[model samples]
Target: MVIRDFDEFCRDITDIYESTLPNGEGQVASYIPQLARVNPDQFAVSLCTVDGQRLSLGDSKVDFSVQSTCKPINYSLALQLHGEHIVHRHVGREPSGRGFNELTLNHDGRPHNPMINAGAIMCCSLLKREGEVNVADRFDLVMDTWRRLGGGTRVKFNNSVYLSERTTADRNFALGYFMREKQAFPTSTDLLETLEFYFQCCSIEVHAEQMAAVAATLANGGICPISGERVFETKTVQHCLSLMYSCGMYDYSGEFAFTIGLPAKSGVAGALMIVVPNVMGICTWSPRLDKLGNSVRGIEFCRRLVATFNFHYDTL
Candidate 1:
């Protein structure tokens, strides 16, 4: 077993979860109406080991939009569809020190990385780019990929969130138009379709239990631990996790990588996915968000997790 004392580990995690409950700091994200309406106090932590052992606590079954957390998944799909050389040609692999929604590109004219809105929009254009598939078919393909990543768990689409995102997507629209103006997208790309696809990807809904399985797939080198399915190539996950470590937490990416020493991605919906490569994958959800948009309780759980266990990369 990857975790020697599984029972004891569960107890420790439970303690951390309980201790984080009293933290009333941070506000729930209000940019999207649907996100703003979610119960801010809802919190959950779920973990799955590479060997498939699982545990969930608090509001484990409650569904929440994946939001920006979908960036890493879509980025992995783009890498699998197109090799690193081609994918990096459109999106750089360095962290953008600006906000996640910043309107900026690298010196090479590509978005800094696929973990930000601009880069994620670029990735959306890459998926199903052959023009053979329609928008619905393309989104269906992404949903299928998400299900495989989560060990065949059901992945739902929240049309309300999707509509809300699209309704309030002036910034994303600006990014799309800016990329188009800069010729950053591939030839014959449909700008509106690409932006809508990006919104749909962000609107994917899964509870912490399912998200833990998704993280575990990445931790197990792109193989879904529960269903034993290969969802992505090992190399694809390697590149994806590298960028996640350096660019996933918006402007706080550097601090997170320095302190946590783990590959993690946080979404405005208060979803945080952490992968302990070759060991386990964890998902923490709490709608209360810090200024950087990370889940407040989720961050606390991670700090307590690494402090209690030798999971940090440096600990090796």
Candidate 2:
């Protein structure tokens, strides 16, 4: 059963956020014309425990595109479909030791890991359905996962954002072709269409409330608290979290793991999700990002969480 302490936890988080949500900060991601238009000052945070407790603050009802934060879910699905050996054939486990959008891969032509731009694209191909692997079907599964995770009855595409991704996706297009040349993505799928689907996956919208639940699934060892279902294998969650621990925050992974001390993921769309092992999931969303494209306020809140709670999965 959901406990009362979690409600107290929420109140503490809300109070902390209200006092310090970054009055002065950096800019939001504007590369994708649509995201550039979002209100930069908007911020939110949410938390959930394995026992089904929940807490939310600051624009809790607002939905935001998940962006690269979508990598872990799709990566888990890819691991389920293709298995580890085959999936590793296309992507590497080592952190790229470079920026996420470096437009390059490891010497072996594999994406350094499955969390960056190069690797996430590889996962999109890896997780695509067998017969046609179209966006509609792939997106339906993402929606299913969201419904199961978020407890929301409905989820839909942000068409304007999706189109903006398509229009400004030249860099990703180039990455796709480079991978294809390396035999990394040796398929007949059109690069634009595949990238379109990738963009749509990033565009899949959810509020901090649902994101807290999604993180709770990971914290609960893959069990959906609200849905009473298992969306991934236990081993898969471990692998996904391990990868997140090592590389999920894009360029900020090491610092994030050190400061926040949680297995976490961040979106260029200014969303953050952190998993606290058997305890709970914490999520923060704010459009303003530091140079690394991680949410500015999101990082500060996590810093406070780690410091105040003495939380750290590694320490556990």
Candidate 3:
């Protein structure tokens, strides 16, 4: 909790994140009008060590949509419920090596991995059980995870954002139907209900501290360091973080894996979270996106943080 190097790293990251913005470049995901109004200049960074030290930088308190990063958390929940062997039958563990919108699945239409849209839909479908009361109950379970992870305060529903995603969600809808076609989805699954839940989950806004805590839970083998509570099963967490390591970044997963050497995930809402086992967990937010649709400043902050802090786990 008291690592001197981490204390200094926080200072540096805070300085960088506080000083940058979207500038005149980078396009927002405006097909959803709710996303269009995000202050392009907003940015934040939050970090926590495995021992529970907290270092907050920039607008780490500012709320932002959870976006695709929700996939792995929900994936963890799915694994906890269904077990690894059953879940693997429906979703592949490999990275898709393309943008998130690409609807094609594996040769068998099994989702390429849980980190992508297709895989996320599949994960959502897997959440639907025969005895489940309704979609809200499932969402409540996810919210319970958020609460235990210290992100409860940051959870806010931007109705407009949800609606906007629904408006432009034809690609996502197509993915669900295509999965259904290939037997990737259950015969009794309700496509629209699943899609709505997925979109709403993506719209849940969380601050960086909550993100850091979530990452720390993964770092600590599924236990929240701050809350001292177990959220998901240990094996399920391992599976989730492993996928984040391989496919968290849509098309840029390869480059990020090669360069960062930390298991991380990014959201279209400009939130990027990284987890280093027993070392630290970090989250960065900058609304300006790079060509890969990742946060430009967020990635820049992580790159600099990794470079300055000696987090190249694989090289060493």
The weakest ten consecutive residues by lDDT in model 1 span 128-137
* Cα RMSD, each candidate: 0.8, 1.8, 2.0
Sort the predicted structures by lDDT, highest score first.
1, 2, 3
- Pairs in clash, predicted candidate 2: none
Clashing pairs in model 1? none
Candidate 2 has its poorest 10 consecutive residues by lDDT at 1-10
Candidate 2, residues 83-148, lDDT tens digits: the string is 888889889998777888888889898899989988988888876656765577777887887777
Q: What is the TM-score of each candidate against the true structure?
A: 0.99, 0.94, 0.94
Error of 1 at 100 (Å): 0.2
TM-score of structure candidate 3? 0.94
Instruction: Count backbone overlaps in model 2.
Output: 0
Q: lDDT per prediction? A: 0.92, 0.83, 0.80
User: For candidate 2, what is the TM-score?
Assistant: 0.94
Which digits, one per residue and each the tens of the lDDT, describe model 3 over residues 1-316? 4466665766776666654543446776666766778888776778887778888866878888889879888898889888988888899999987788796788777989999999998888888576674888898888777777663344666677788888888899999888888888766788889899999889887888888888888888888888778887788878888899899987888888889877889999888888887677788877777788888877676677667667867753
Write candidate 1's Cα lDDT for 76-107 as tens digits: 99988888998888999888899999888888
Candidate 1 ranges with C-alpha deviation above 4 Å: none
